[model samples]
Target: MSDIQDRHDSGGSGAGCGCLAVALLLAVVAVLLGRPFLTDDGDGGAQAAPEESVVATPTSERPRSKKPSGRRPGVVNIFTEQGLRGVRAAGTGIVVDPSGLVLTNNHVIQGATEIEGTDTDDRRTYPAQVLGYQKSGDIALIRLSGASGLKTAKFAEKWEVRLGDVVTAVGNAGGKGGTPSVVTGKVTALDRQITATDQSDGSSERLTGLIETNAPIKPGDSGGPLLNTSGQVIGMNTAASAGFDLEKKGASRGFAIPSAKALEIVRQIQRGEASDTVHIGRTALLGVQVRQPTTPSGGRAGGAYIADLIPGTPAEQAGLRARTTIVALDDEPVDSPGSLTDMLLRHHPGDTVRITWTNAAGERRTTPVTLGDGPPQ
Candidate 1:
C-alpha cells in the first residue's frame, strides 16, 4: 500500500505505477471482506449511509419496486349529511363484504349530510345506503348503490396486528368532498377505553374494545382505516386527541375498533333490515375484565378467571364472585376468556345464562342468571 501511494505521489512515468493498480485491487478486496466483520448500524458507532437503506431495498427479494402503495383499491371516500352543508366533518370507510357493507365509526355518520362513496378513481361516485349503526360500538354499516364487482378490504387477524407495527390511515382528513387523503403511524396501544364527552352533552361515553394507535387522525378522518403493515384493514379509526379523564393529557392517542367487532356491524347493515341495530333495554355485562387463558383443560387453570367483577353486576347479582373460575357456558366448556366473552355476548342483557364451573375447592357449581348491561363504548 505504501509503495503504491509513493509511486502515485512521485507521478511515475510508466503509465501510472502498476503497484497502484495492484493496490486498487487489494483495496477492493479489503472493502468486500471488511463489511462482514463490521457490526450493523446500531452496534457500530458509524452507519453505512442514509442512501444505503434505499440501495439495500433494491436487493431485497421482495424488492421495494414490487411493493404496492395500497393505492389500487379497497378504499372509498365517505360523504356524510354534513357534506351537503359544506361541513368538513366526514370520515372514511372500507368495504368489508361482497354485498357492499362498509364499516366506519358511529360518530362519522351521526349527522351525515349526504352519504356518498367514491372509489380510488374519484370519477365514479355512487350514492351510499346506510343500513344501520350501533353507536355503542362506534360501528355503522353502509353499502354502495348496486355495487357489483367491488374490491373488498382484506382484514388482518388479531395475531397479525402486533404492537409497534407500522400502520396507515386513508381518509379525507380535510373532508374535501370527493378527494381522499392518507395518514401513517404506528400501533402504540390496545384494548383501551376512553371516557370522554361526545359532541353534545356534559356526560361522557366510554369507548371500548379500542386498539390505540398514534395514527394521525384528523376531524374528518374518523371511520377511516387503521391498516396493518401489509395494508390490511385491522381497525376503524374512531377518535383522536380525545380529552378523556384517564389519559386527559394526551395527543394523537387515537382509538379504533378492531376489525373483528367492526365486521359484526357491517354484516348487520348488509342484511338490509331497518332494525339491524339490536337495541336492548339492558344487555348482559359480565363485569369482569379477564385475560384469555393459555391452555384448555379440566380444572380452573384453563378457563376464564374473574379478573374484576362489578359489585352489583349481573354476574355478581347471580352470586358470581371474584376469583371464581368460569368453566362452561350453557353446557359447553369454556376453554379461555375469549370463549366466555363470545358465549356471553351471544345472549342479550336480559337473556338467561347458565354458568357451570368447578370451584377452587374442586366442588362443581352451576349458577343460572340473567345477564346485565353489556360493555358499550
Candidate 2:
C-alpha cells in the first residue's frame, strides 16, 4: 500500500516539474499472453474512514442526487503494456458514459501500445483506444471499442469535500484486474501539492491542488476513484508519496486530482483542444531518446542530444540518427529536452515539420519529416 503522509500548504513549492520523461510508472507484475498485468498484495496496511458521520456541507458541494447509491459497478480496471519503454502499468478507470467512455490517469497508461479494460460487472475484457491526454496534468481519456450497457460513475459536483469528511477509495489493488480493493480514510487535507517520482523509471511529476487523504493508494491504484459516502467520485487517485519511503512499500501518502478539475480536462480533450501542452487524439512520437547537456556551472544547457531513435520511426525516416543534437524545430530554438517535447506536442500525427540538428561531425543539418501516431506519452 502507498502512504502519502504529509500536511500541505497552498504556497506551493513549485520546482522540478517539467516536460520530458524516461519511464512511465510500471504497475505490471506479469505479461500474460503478451498483455501486461499488474499484481500487488491487497491494501497491505492502509487505513479506512469512520463508520458513519454527518456529511458536512463544505463550500464545494454540488447539487447531489436525492438518493445517492453507495455501490459502484462503473469502476473499470485499466491494464496496459508499454512496448517501447518495456513498462507495464495498471490502474482503475471510471466509466463516464453508456457508450464506453473511460477516464484514467495519463501515467497509468503512458507509453502503452496496447490498452485494455475490464468492468466490475463483466468478466470479459475489452480493447481500448486513447481518446486524449494531458501529460502535465496527468489525466487521460480512453474509449472501449464496441462496448455498451456500461454503468457510469457519478461525480460529486459543488465541491462538497471537507478536511474531515469520510472518503472511500476503490481500485484494482494488485493489477489483479478483477474486483477492486476498497479502503476508507478521512480527507486529511485539501489543495495539497506534491512531487511524486515513478520508482520504476525515475520520472517525476509535480502535482498541485490535490486532495490529501489518509486512505491508502497502492501500486496499481493510479486512476482509481476517491469516492464520497454516496459512492460519488470526488477525485481521481493519481500519485502517492515516495519521499523517505522510496524503498518501503505502503510508506508514502496518497494524493488525488479533484474530479471537477479532471472532468474539465477531459471535456477539453473531447472537444479536440490541441495545444503546446495538450494532445487531442492519439499521441505523436519522434522515436528518439534525448539527453540534456550541462553548462560550465553544472546547470542544464541548451540543445537536446539524440542518444537513440527507434528503427523505422519518423526520426529515422527523416535521416536522423544517434549522436545528433537537435537545435531547433519549425525554426524554434530547442533549449532543452523538454522544450523539444513541448514544440512537438503542438502538432498531431501526419503533420510535416522541418527538423534542424547538428550532426556528430559538427555540421548543422535539416530534414522534413511527417510525424507518426505512436502510443500515449
Best model number under TM-score: 2
Model 2, residue 189: C-alpha shift (Å):
1.0
- In model 2, which range of ten residues has the least summed lDDT? 27-36
Q: Please list the C-alpha lDDT of all candidates, in the order they appear.
A: 0.51, 0.65
Candidate 1 lDDT (Cα, whole model)? 0.51
For candidate 2, write residues 255-331 as lDDT tens digits: 77888778888888888877765678866667776666555598866787776777778888879877778888888
List TM-scores for all candidates, in order: 0.50, 0.78
RMSD of every prediction: 23.9, 10.1
lDDT, residue 203, model 1: 23
lDDT of 2 at 79: 72
lDDT of 2 at 199: 34
The deviation in Å at residue 135 for candidate 1 is: 0.9
